[model samples]
Target: MTTSLVRIGLATALLLGSIGAAAAHAHLKASTPAAGTTISAAPAELRLGFSEGVNLKFTGVVVTGPAGVVATSTAAMAPGDDKTLVVPVAGPLAPGAYKVEWHALATDGHKTDGSYSFTLKP
Candidate 1:
């Protein structure tokens, strides 16, 4: 009976570990002009940090301001970093509420996307 219980416990532990690993998708861990910030000057670029490494080809960000869609430069991985995505503002950001929507494909082949907002002071 003791040996049987030990096997069951080991198996349960292994199963739980695998489940945790399987749930590890690239989630948005952080961002620049960070969620809900109020800034005096428009940021030249936007930066996002993820929980895992991301594929630059499959990562993107769309920003919109009070006027409408704010154009952004092509998305790229931060220099020397695989977990940070950077998008440049095409021009000076106007004062207003800006929303940034992002999508990411992690190295693990999982895709995740999310959005946040920041207020630019006049």
Candidate 2:
């Protein structure tokens, strides 16, 4: 009975391990300027890279200043690379600390959201 229980436990462990690996969700491998990086000047665009292809329409970002939201552009999909999505940040974002909140839905159907703040040096 003890040996039988041990075998069942091992099998269950293996099954769970395989399922966990297969159920892994898409990840954000890297982003230009990085998530916590601060720039002296306003960036021309916001670039985010992912581990796998994602739906750009569902990938959205909102930049908010001390006053309120600064950008109104909807989520814009990047061409050529399905794993990358970019938002065009037009005009100049005044010098100050800004908060960027973003959400992305991977092709695997998992949704993730994150927020970061950066200071605009004078």
Candidate 3:
């Protein structure tokens, strides 16, 4: 009876583990021109890293500053890296606070979104 119960418990644990893995969503892991830091010069491109591989077709970023919406080129995944999103700035940014809003869909079909802020110094 004890052996049977142990076998059942192991089976349950394996099932739950697989479910948790399948439900994983992409989360922001890091960034260049990173969150909350002030930089002297604007970066030509923004790089956002995620906890899991994301679908580039379903991921995007919107940046806003004191002037209003900033222009950015289309976003793309870094070469050989499915977990990093790279966005190119269309022009130099004026010194001010900026917010980056992003949304991503994991390869597994889970969606996630979040925002962060940074500043440029004169």
- Which candidate ranks first by lDDT, i.e. highest? 3
Model 3 lDDT, residue 119, Cα: 96
**Model 3 error, position 8 (Å):** 12
lDDT of each: 0.89, 0.74, 0.94
**What ranking of all candidate models by lDDT puts the best one first?**
3, 1, 2
Predicted candidate 1 versus true structure: per-residue lDDT over 17-120, tens digit per residue = 78866876788888888898899988999999999898999989888899899988888898999999989898877799999989998887789899999999
Q: Candidate 3 — which residues are off by over 4 angstroms?
A: 1-18, 21-23
Clashing pairs in 3: none
lDDT at position 25, candidate 2: 54
When summed lDDT is taken over every stretch of 10 residues in candidate 1, the lowest stretch is: 17-26
Whichever of 2 and 3 has more lDDT, that candidate is 3
On residues 1-122, what C-alpha lDDT tens digit does candidate 3 reach at each position? 69999999999999987896776889999999999999999899999999999999999999999889999998999999999999999988999999999999999788999999999997
Query: What does the lDDT come to for candidate 2?
Result: 0.74
2 or 3, greater by TM-score: 3
